[model samples]
Target: MNLFATFEERVAQALRNLQQAGDLPGDLDISRAVVEPPRDPAHGDLATNAAMVLAKPAGTNPRALAEKIAADLASDPRIVAAEVAGPGFINLRLDPAIYRDMLRAVILLGEEYGRGTGQDTRPVNVEYVSANPTGPMHVGHGRGAVFGDALCALLAFAGHDVSREYYINDAGAQVDVLARSAFLRYREALGEEIGEIPEGLYPGDYLVGVGQQLAQTYGPGLHDHTEAEWLPVVRDAAIEAMMAMIRDDLAALDIRHDVFFSERSLMAGGTDAVAATIADLRARDLIYEGRLPRPKGAPDEDWEDREQTLFRATEFGDDVDRPLLKSDGSYTYFAADIAYHRSKFERGFPVMIDVWGADHGGYVKRMQAAVKAITRGEGALDVKLCQMVRLLRDGEQVKMSKRSGEFVTLREVVDEVGSDAVRFMMLYRKNDAPLDFDLVKVREQSKDNPVFYVQYAHARCHSVARQAAEAFPQADLSPENLATRAAASQTAIDPAELELLRRIAQYPRIVEAAAKAHEPHRIAFFVHEIASLLHQFWAKGKDSTHLRFVNQSDEESSLERLALAYAIRCVIASGLRILGVAAPDEMR
Candidate 1:
């Protein structure tokens, strides 16, 4: 169903024929050869760089090889013409039947139309939205959440067994801080008005519920207990409460993780996986006691030359060897993270992808290094760094401060603007770039908003379908009927329909490429392009009565145009599903 791939193979077979005929060398490498849409549609349906890629290796003139390849390709029934264009490029003009058959294939396949040879499935663990269990999720975390969720969906569509994971930052000082913050509220709940929240503690009213729960459970029996006596009880309560709130926030956007792995669990249950991982590394001589460089770009006033337990991360492509334990003999966050990833590997996930915030950019190389050393290069780790997000309204920046306990939560954004807007707008751009999320523009019901525009295309397609059904009640407008026909009605295709088909046919390849490149933003762009084409065609129908999808006088032509519209709806729906956005039948 992938025409480009089909034609690429055709070109390769032509090359092999030339080699067998003794006209070209058999050692020519065709890996770089590609078949794709021409720069200008008027040039041809598809173009290939076979001659240019193989000419040097084959020891032949570029144009001469191109001519030979063109001749061989022209022999194919589907390829109507293949001409040598500028500097040995071959522009292929395919028979219109190829496109008609593609439309037929689309109608026949429906949602499964563009799915490529996703190659069975590979176990991929996509860990995202691993926000600290201190408070509700923030905007930056929301970006990574949507990107990762959409990525998992894309991978699934491309046949990957994806595990949506959330790594709780619960085993660290932050959770203890969360407990202290809630303990202040607990005392307040017990009628002792604790003054302003102390510094280095979470300052949020969300933890007030945890305080109430503590007051109800222990009633004032533990009010006078020392820090050691109450720390675990209160810390565990706060983490559980905060994680509940986090899950609720994520649910508002309709996102759910398959696994919520706790960092504390790595060292819990009387089994310290972190220690075992370090021991394994120590046995391999990758772990050692060493001293690290004092400082780099920032000031480290208390820099010490003390020896610490370190991992030889440099051997696995890290900038420097990394520490496995903190000065207090407790395993570092990196140590637990290494254990978590090693566990993922042991659980049969050889491919691990972490969608992290931009601030974690410096941590990527080291994490990749750890995965390599732990799995002995059998496992691969790819970290996607999501940049900051600036929420804007009326062209003005909306500032927030979580330290002041006043920040925009992911729940608030989704509740106000709806999940569809939040999901689509988050994926409208590449994750690596900073995004300016305008509150006003995304909700606008105009072409200015991509989400609205793309959804409108799907709506418009269905609207046209309904109209066609109403106008031609007796016409055989079933997908089987319309698709089985040569044209919509045997009428010559307007250039617009041809252009739309070309773009429609590009979906399968786009899915495969985006899945391979790990970019779901490509789907957003493709949907928008399809919408624009449909809109252009709809606009054209206003001036030309014959261009209108409904033809009361010619039922066959009407069914054909409606068939095209239905195909467009199918594509937009499939593409939108990949983006985790709904493709409504009507744009209400």
Candidate 2:
């Protein structure tokens, strides 16, 4: 199914044949030899660096080795010509029938056309959008949620056992602030004349719902209790309410996590798991008591020269040892995170990823260092930081202040545009770069919005299929008939037809490269490329009637072209699905 892989295998077999015939050195290593598409499409269909990679090992000049490999490759029926290019790269021009056969593969496979097998051996966990349960999710969390969910889908499509996770920071001080805020609302719900919220408390209308719920449950009967008796009761109530709101918000954006890990659960029982994890690292001499020097740029106000429990993060490339416990003898946030990661490693996932906001960029090295110390460098942790999002409306800023509780939530954005538009626009940029999301621009029907452009391509293909059915009443267009039809026209290809097939053939390679680089933005770019090709091919039909899909005179030729269009539509749908975007059958 991977044309590039197939071509590389053929080239390797040819090289081995040469060695067996004593035409080349027998001791050369060709593992690095690879075949890929040429950067410039006009150069060739595919290019390889077999000779260049083997030159020094085989004790031969690159150009000489390239010419030898070219002669050997030209012997194959699929290869029309193999020419030696600059230095030792071999540019390959394949028989057009090979591309035609690939189009048939697409038609036969449909939405499953480009699914891969390399990821079948491992399990991956992608944890993201773990924004605190204190408030509704904002635009920043939207990007992380989309990226992590799309990454999970991509890995799953590529055959990995993928799990989407969200870590709930319910055990932190922020939730206590939330509880006190809700308590005030609870008093107000009891008809007390509570004044404006104090300086250090949460002031948002969201807690009004939680307060109302508390009022419905307890009424005025719970007002006489002390903070000690009522804090835990209302804290749990407030967290549940806030989490319910968060889940609804995520649901609006079409994101769902398989696991929701609670930080409070790690220390709920008599056994403190954070202490247990630190003890495990201490046994390995990774934990020590030390005093951290003041940070280079800014110093903490309460920082004093005193000995404290710390993790030896410097051994794993961190700037300094990180504090494990705070001044009050309570575990720091970093300590809780260490236990969380240990729990992940114990669950047997060799690879783990945490999607965080860009403000947490400085925390990456320390978290990585902690993972290394816990797993003794046996586990992997990658932190993906999503930069800020600037919202604009009609080219003017859509202003909102996080401090004022006036910012638009993720749910509102999804409700305005749609889940498809929100997911596509969020992933249209690299994770580390700041993004400008224009509310006015993304809703447009023009090509400026990539979501509409790609979806329009899918819709056009469906339109072609509908028109073809009317033109060729005898052709079977159902999935059950696709196999027989694919077998019938396996070797039929035109110039424009071959171009569309080439894009389909590149799908698996793009998936593998993007997965390896941990870059989901590549998926957006690839979708754009395929959409461009489909649009160009569609436009060509307007100028040349012979290239059109619905030929009134020849039923067979029209069916064949419809089959090709169907294949392109299948590829577009599969790619769009992986990106968590919908491939609509109609634009309106």
lDDT of 2 by residue, 1-588 (tens): 789989999999989988998878788787789999987777779999999888888888999989989999999999999999899899999987776567667777789877878644767878999989988888888999999888888878777788799999999889998889899999999889899888788787888878889999999766899988888899999999889988999998788999999999899878788989988989988888878787667885334578988788899988788888888899889999999999998888768988999998878998998888888788889898999999888789877744337687887778888898888888889999999998888899998898899899899989988897887677787754654555566444667767777778898888888776677778888887788888888788899887887788877677777777788788889888999898988889
Please give each candidate's TM-score.
0.96, 0.95
Q: What residue runs in model 2 are displaced by over 4 Å at the alpha carbon? A: 21-28, 300-304, 401-404, 479-493
lDDT (tens digit, per residue) of candidate 1 on 46-120: 999998988888778999999999999999999899999988999999988888888888988888878765684
User: Which number leads on TM-score?
Assistant: 1
Clashing pairs in model 1, backbone N/Cα/C closer than 3 A: 488-560
Q: Candidate 2: how large is its RMSD? A: 2.1
lDDT of each: 0.88, 0.85
